[model samples]
Target: MSSIDFSEALDCLKKAQSVLISCHVRPDGDSLGSAAGMAQMLGSQGISAEIILPSELPDRYAFLFEQARPRVVTDDWRRAQLRGFDTVVIVDTSVRAQLEPQYDFLKSCNLPVLVIDHHLESENIGTVELLDPSASAVGLMVAELGEVWPAELSAGGAKALFTAIASDTGWFRFPNADSRTYCQAWRLLQAGVRPTEVYRSLYMRDSVGKIRLLGRALGSLELFCEGRLACMSLLKEDFRQSRAAQTETEGLINESLRIGSVIAAVMLTEDENDSIRVNFRSKRQINVARIAERFGGGGHELAAGAQLAGSIEQAKEKIVSAIREEFSRSGEPGGE
Candidate 1:
């Protein structure tokens, strides 16, 4: 939770000759956008920077990189690539668990690490950490960095940054979208970012399989804690039946929050490896991130996620029990 100033982060980058950028696994718009934006910012400054992902880039975000190809690391030996860079910049997350495939390299590499994240929890994963819990998105932090670094945002960079801030704020519909978020959005718009195109690329281009996946996830919805909580799951069979890619599960959990009476929602998906991916979202005072942390996960107060090794049913039971316990501790009735 200790955040460093932008000047400090800029100073670290100022010393780097080459940079390797990265974000959390299962890259979302926020993480992808921030990483892309950071790469562009560094590139404009004449620093050779490239993005290295722990996983494949989601198809929905492929438009952001029409001009560049980010390296997707698939093996342990790829860790040697870390030695080639003077610095590593990890956007959107500071948790070691989220770093995944690169976690070992990051832990062992002597190269300076700069973490730009807004999550409430972090491991001592960075040599210079720019952790800001107040910023709505790490992209917002990057936008602010552009101003301080005095770097110009290319048309692509503006679009990438806009996607970062907008996605993390639920397109400004979430409670986290404060005035700062809107102001940054305005700045990107002034920089010639076309929101309509970005919106269409992100939302309107869903594959049919994604629609089927959404339907299946919604079909599994169950009410809990007297209708105050909603839980949903998508099994391995669900994915096979829907023919949906894992990335399509991105926003499924948020749909349950649309329920008029539900204050919190959970989405549990069975990964191919049989691990359960749990995503938590809330619309009120409950800190779902705290609940996630109990199970070795962390995120913002209202939104968070974790992965558990168990059957989907077992994962659901543990998650539901934890949410109910959190509700009880928060002094809300009907937690039983």
Candidate 2:
């Protein structure tokens, strides 16, 4: 729970004529949904709001904003537009490094930054931050803000927010999903969001290339710590062979944790820069966020990620060793 008052954020929003909404790099459903929903909410109040993503929007979520797609800032000219806003709203992430393309521009801009997020660890980047680690997702927090502000959500906004909440909470299966989460879902449904339609669009629309990529990822699975830890790798060649983009790897890590014997799962993917992107997921008590922070990344407790500056083999060795040490210190069954 952040000590910052939500009223202060509302006051800032009330005075602003224009707003720029952004999220972390490699934006996920929650990030995109929150941004799009927030933009619509602000627009309903006659405020000009635009979203700037650090990278291209993944194909799956592009439907959330059919007519008003967010601008993906790639070069300096597009990035420079961030300075034109009266207020900036950072959603789903507060980590500075996560805002790569706009980081320098945002730092130089003499504007108020309002952060709305649900992560446990956050950098102090916003003048007014509404952060609740207990919330299932940032969309939940945004919904609560809508109630506080008495903002009327359009049908599209409701659908986008539902996508945000559903994606981040694993469709209400994650531990963070609570009574309030369901209540908000109900509210969004009342506002004309069709859950089945959203679910079909999100889960049932995978392509053949994504399935091939999943096969390659599963083929690379390896077990350690006597089956308590499962690790998988997706090489740069995997993408080429499968004709799959990196975004297709989104849910692969969780698949490794499905085995009955595995307590923790790690997905190591070779990035274009030759670095390894590490994604972590745990079933029970492991705090993967702490593990990610040790490697200069941060996320939630059960689900987290980090980028390692090394070969995939080196990253695997280091991360496996760290997981082993964690198990030993915690007196878990896998400790040797």
Give, for candidate 2, the lowest lDDT window spanning 10 residues: 75-84
What lDDT does the true structure give each of the candidates? 0.88, 0.89
lDDT tens digits, residues 1-336, model 1?
Answer: 113368889999989889989999888899999999988889899888989898999889999899877888877556556667889899988888788877887667788899999999888699999988989999999998888778989889999999998899988899989888888888889988999999999899999999999999999999999898999999989989999988789888999999888999999989888899899999987899999988888888999988899898899899988889888988877486
The TM-score obtained by model 1 is 0.95
Runs of candidate 2 exceeding 4 Å displacement = 1-5, 78-84
> In model 1, where do residues sit more than 4 Å from their true spots?
1-4, 76-84
Instruction: State residue 101's C-alpha deviation in candidate 1, in Å.
Output: 1.7
Best by lDDT: 2
For candidate 2, what is the TM-score? Answer: 0.96
